[model samples]
Target: MAPVISSLNPNHGPPTGGTAVTINGSGFTGVTSVKFGIVAVASFTLVSDSQITTTAPAGTGSVALTVTSPLGTSNGVTYTYSVGPVITGLSPASGSTSGGNTVTISGSGFTGASSVHFGTASASFTVVSDTQITATAPGGTGSVPVTVTTSVATSSNVTYTYVNSTAPVITGLNPNQGPTSGGNTVTISGTGLSGTSSVLFGSHSATITAITSTQITVTAPGGAAQPVSVTVTTSAGTSNALPYFYITAPTIAGLIPTTGPGGGGNAVTIFGSSLALTSAVHFGSAAATNITVNSDSQITATAPPNVGTVLVTATTPGGTSTVGLGDAYYIYVAAPVINSLIPATGSVSGGDDVLISGSNFTYIDAVFFGTAPASFAAVSDTQVVATSPAGAVGPVIVTVHSSGGTSNGATFQYQL
Candidate 1:
């Protein structure tokens, strides 16, 4: 029985074709060969008694495709060999999500383009020549395939991406606050920061140091000691505003009871302007403890262990206080020591004149004999004379007290 020709799945392919073609008909079993025009297909396979599949041999234009069996040859079926349109590139390959932009398509084999398409949406286009077609982009989003179709075949696709034109969004700022002297670099983190045109800190324009799609760094502009808004502008639009605070330098006026013990730990009240926001207090380089901000003009702190005189300073959100400002001086004095008593023995009747000898006798305020108070007179920086008050007829310790602190006691025997 002779093979009978039915149909081809794809009627056409490139002239250099390796197109897989299927022929359908009864009596296709034991097909001796398959041929396109005079050129024979390299190979053929019979799937069943009714169908044979083969690769279309390389040829040009329309050709007669046929199958032959052991019984005879089948009738000819028409198969076309063709080269379809190709798009190598497109001008302005990207456009806004809302399309309607003119795009110049460049390539070859477009003499009779049946239609142009962005993805599945057909678009109106003019076949400029056999190599070019000027088309208007249709509305779309993200990336889509663009292709040209002819009566013979649809061309392989090139991609055209649609850009989202949303304004930039700010997520955070590094070093969002700084001193009023604006020269610090501020880094802004966000999305869609590309193509930034301007950066602003309040009404002042900032110098852009670097920029990218996700981040931008700019030199902040100087402004008043207050809060300001920061923003960035791009081609799409302006970003949302963020806050930046400009702080002033702190100051110190004076300190109450500027004199304390060298061993420290005395409660000292600090008086100054702009003290409400104080975060830390320092005496020279030593840090203070138990800081309390009573008002914008008063602060109390425990003086740290130190000696000699040094300036007291406060640190706030603004800045650390500078030296030579206000009366911030503090004096550190050592406690009075009673190393010996010139007359160790005193009458228990209580009027015993004793000469106290030790270091740090200056600023001595009180003298004590055992548990009783004594009248004292400072004679020198290392000496004090005291008249002992009535005390128990036994051993009584003698000591001296100064603004700096209390001193170690020296034992004195009182005889009856």
Candidate 2:
């Protein structure tokens, strides 16, 4: 048996077996059989005494190709099956709280893929071509090996990890002030949040509905609550703590009326919580001489003096609550009303003494030209002598604050 062997022109192909390989050498004419390793060839054509074209077989890795003829057995020619399709890289390793991501796998030898796996779970894959594959990822935890299988063999490990990325945190909440039987929806914020399992206000579990990567809207749970820490949990882990407070709506615990002066200079105290930052005290239609927030539960205000019934209102962040009718005070002084003033025009540069005549002047405390203070002396129950303060020469409001409620501003003038 005399024969000569050359080589396989093109030796590698898909595992599905569709590639033209040319074996070139002498004694190929009377060839009886052509073998791709142990696998038999599908078909072949002897182009010449030195050329024979055949299809490559299905397998993984390399194999030798040979042809047997009546003349002799041809020499073995190298034919590599090629390392089957591999998973080179995966895009987004993590998905959403909803979970359903179509990912791409890039690598070589993907010509005849049969199946794709995300961890042990099988994923639907589409062979887009030779080097690209699109597959829907299955529900999995942590990182798992991604593999691709062909008619020949399965490729090894590729990393694809699932993660819960949500940042749900509580910033500030109301009633600072809710009942201990918690049922308040508190707004929470942060980032990277999803698939939340639970929300905790201290040890109490808050019911949560809307959970996102940025925020979690939750209803507070009941407790011996004042202000407590809030936490959220996911499959990955629990979140950091935040503070929430529960407070009682402010109440007008009491008012100091009997102790307050009949002339209205006396400071009246109020007790309450959840008080608005700027709570005003009013006596009848007239506001107090001075109002001050002592704390969440207390306010000290000067009663506006006038003999009549008055109501005290305690306002808070939640809403407003009134304690008593005439609870603030029923004083015995006449409210000063600006009737008229003589010599109303004066120079702001001092040296101007003007007569301010109005009813109930005995309770007059001080007069102001706009915001500028002026010195005045009580001339009688209806007269006041005041020197205008040095200030910007403009139309001024001469107010007469007194033991009674402040008078309506009397218009005056300041000459340059």
Collision pairs in model 1: none
Model 1 TM-score, 2 decimals: 0.55
Residue 234, candidate 1: C-alpha displacement in angstroms: 3.4
Candidate 1 lDDT, 313-370, residue by residue in tens: 9987566888655789999989887788989998888887899999998888899998
Considering every candidate listed, which one attains the maximal lDDT?
1
TM-score of each: 0.55, 0.34
Provide the global lDDT of candidate 1 against the true structure.
0.86
What are the per-residue Cα lDDT tens digits for candidate 2 across 1-416?
65577766765665556677888888777887888888888788989988888877676667778888887776777777666667778765555433456778988767788889987889888999889898888777777888998754588768887875444544444334455556767777765456676788888888887877767888777776377887776644567887776554455656654433355667777765556453566666667757777676677877765564555665443345555333433444566777776887877686588788778777567787788788888889988888878866777887887656678888887777
Q: What lDDT is reached at residue 210 by model 1?
A: 97
The CA lDDT of each predicted structure is 0.86, 0.70
Worst 10 residues of 1 by lDDT: 317-326
